[model samples]
Target chain A: MLTQTVRMLGRLGETVVKGVAEMGFAAVLLGEALFWLAMGRRREQPVRLAPIVAEMTEIGLRALPIVTVLAVTIGIMLAIQGIYTLRMFGAESQVVPGIAFSVVREFAPLITGILVAGRSGSALAARLGTMRINQEVDALQVMGISPVRFLVVPPLVAMLVMVPSLSLWSILVALGGAGVYVSSTLDMTFAAYARQCLEMLTLGDLAHGMGKSFIFAVLITLVGVVNGASVSGGAEGVGRMTTRSVVQAISAIVITDMIFVFLVTR
Target chain B: MNGVDRTSSRVAIEVRDLVTHYGERKILKGVSFDILEGEILVIMGGSGSGKSTLLNHLLGLLRPTSGAIRLLGVDITKAPPREMQALRRKMGVAFQGGALFSSMSVGDNIMLPLREHTRLDRKTMEIMARLKMEVVDLAGFENLMPAELSGGMIKRAALARAIVMDPKLLFCDEPSAGLDPVVASSIDDLILRLRDAMGMTIVVVTHELESAFKIADRILVLDKGEIIGLGSVDEIRNSASERIQNLLHRRTEEVELDADAYLRRLTGEE
Candidate 1:
């Protein structure tokens, strides 16, 4: 039994290592595809253009109002906390720059990615994974359609086009809410706060944040497609993979954000 | 090969010593079969009998462990990507779940293959898709999503998509599964009609005994990864093997269980 357990442990370790290696290769391949997409090769199937439009509306556009409201609420919480801490330190004036940098540079995109991963990413994985496990992928293949080219590519293209837009929207809401808070509570001019945000937050800040969001968006969709493609066992298997996709996507976003922070901030 | 050689000499589909394994357990142990020009071969098996695995192997969806699978006389076991694509253009499969893309309407599902494999214009593809849908008796369902269709409707729609390309070989995995008896019989009729209309070879994997009996020109039954019986339905029924006899007649009624029950009562129920 001891030897069996040791053997099992060794196999588990090998499996994990192999999975990581495969994921690395997949990442390289996906990155190459994305790069080529940027260069040329449109490979767009516009036959389902209407459905793609509807899905984009449902996944990206519909979530905007909710995201805006959530960002405002969180921004207010951040302002209140910043005010209390800065008051104790006699450094209340830093509140504008403090909340502004954090929101525009990090919190806004990260929080929105997490929210969308929970809401949209899981839905994508579950919907696609269910289709996959039920043999819809095979059906597409037999139909001479590439499942990756059809199902995976469109949503990913939608994400690449929409996530940066969503992140920019999130940053605006957060900074706007912070400006309102500073004007009302700290007796500071809204113009001054807004000016500081514009001056302190460079294109670098916004671009870095958008870059992270874009990678996160791609990661979310890739995980969804991969998990969906690899699904087996049955319905319960799909459910489990969907849940894991969401969790893994969120974790991947956070880790990527940290790495981006280190690289950009350094 | 020239186009004439391809047309005259090509054997639609072939399988030789196909084996499939999941993890440690082997499911198909050197299974070999072929769908010749315009033949309908029904693969029958109890659950877990590897019929689906064999079908998947033929479809090039699952690579066999160590065997050759040829489609249209070209060995697809190591076929190049372009060749695989060309081979796929000449065949279609209807999966057990009737796996129509949930996101696409019935018309789109039927149109997808034409769009992928042909240079036909939108108008022509639309007409062809409509024609295929009408063939499957799903003409008005063009606008409906797969989610909106009933089980039998989904199956029929899938069949429509399968034949939309006028494929040389059609693979149907459990075409009658999870359908009403009337619908199952109707689907069998559709298979026959399609065969007659197109002279297309077909391979159907199903365990529904009645459906198998109805449509099969030849039947192959698998038990635990081995072919236990292969012949016409009449031959299978008259098989001398005890397992085949038991399956055909369903011999459970012959057992006398009252002896065990009486003994349990006499022994005061353990």
Candidate 2:
């Protein structure tokens, strides 16, 4: 029984240590990525603009159809829910302002974060993990190319640019959906619904959602790359880490969103 | 004879008393050897015999528990990252399973190191890449993706990429493991041609007795992480070491073990 307890504690300690080591590795990866991005040209190892653009097309543009469909559904649902909920207090007209404010400040970035974490974030992990298994990463190393600079930074740059744009796009599309619903279901014109939304929403409100997505982008990239770089056990390991990348990315984005909200409110 | 003559008898790689461990299990125990410029050193060992571990050490992928490896006059174990990178430009490694990047076409994969490391013109880079493909007999396959290639073709493409920059030191890890005998023989021929034609010092790690004999200027036989024999091919074949004989003859080993010690090791008490 004594040995059992000791073994349990040892396992727990080992987990904690591994977690810390993973974090350290991630921090170093991020640092190297930033360094290469900033100084790569001077050092003759420039983070090529071509790969970043390709990644942007994959991570952002290819995701457009789903983002559009989901945004519209979410907007319509929010309007229907908010209108009925506020009608209990005889404030049905207030639903326009409510939908606009919530979508811009919270829903847009949060939903997009989860969507992207499930989509491109999982792809990044799986791709990198497969490369790791194939020893392609080692091939890069022996050729004197830093694997982080070659593999991670392109997607890093792409994610940093594209996620915020997607969030902003989500905000606009969702508000449009809400406006259509409000115009059809109520006495308010679509123009009036849009006008009310414009009045209620501030530049700061737009920044709040876009800003949160910016942070989420970093979280997603870091989680994916870190899990990828640490993958072992071959094909099974790649699949495991790809799933973990999505889960951990979503959690990190949500927690970071909370922290951002707290600090912004302060 | 371009600058440094390949047959000048200079030591291209010098390993001294290399020691390593994984947890408490000692792997390479005070191993030492040298390879002359343009020579082919075949390191022969079975699985878990520490050849891979030693290769990783030589490549600077894994730091040894102790001792040093010098490649081209710079001690790799203690070299700075910048120096290592510079040294890597003069060295190439063709990994087991032909680790070509799946995302790139054969041409792109071969030219990757040049594109990353050099400031050559696009035309020059393309010409160099094509030249390597031709050298590895993959001239018409440049447009194909790595996934589209057969196993033998992938290995040849990997060899092309490894030698594209004309590295002075080349290492091939299990170059023939998964290929059929015909393909394997071709890979052996390619290794010999690379040495003779390019004058690159080569080290090949394999358990295949026939391939080693065909290509090795010298062979180093390792067993249980120790060098049981190191000599020319004929010398190694004639050596009286039972371990070397067993390895060469593909005989099953009947290891005599002390029961008490074995039990202690199994129980984690020793």
Candidate achieving the largest TM-score = 2
Model 1 Cα RMSD, 1 decimal: 5.9
lDDT for B48 (candidate 2): 88
* Tens-digit lDDT string for candidate 1 (B1-270): 001122354466677887778887899998776556776778887667787777787888887788898878889889886677777888978888888887788898889888777779999999999999899999888999999999899999989999998999999999999899999999999998888789788899997888988888778888678788877778987889776666566453255568888899898763
Tell me how each candidate scores on DockQ against the true complex: 0.53, 0.79
Would candidate 2 be rated incorrect, acceptable, medium or high by CAPRI criteria?
A: medium
How many clashing residue pairs appear in each of the predictions shown?
0, 0
Q: Please give the distance, in angstroms, between residue A205's alpha carbon in candidate 1 and its true position after superposition.
A: 1.9
Off by over 4 Å in 1: A1-52, B1-10, B250-270
- Tens digits of per-residue lDDT, candidate 2, A224-251, equal 9999988999899999999999999998
Tens-place lDDT digits, model 1, residues A133-164 = 87887877766566666676667777776777
TM-score of chain B of each: 0.87, 0.94
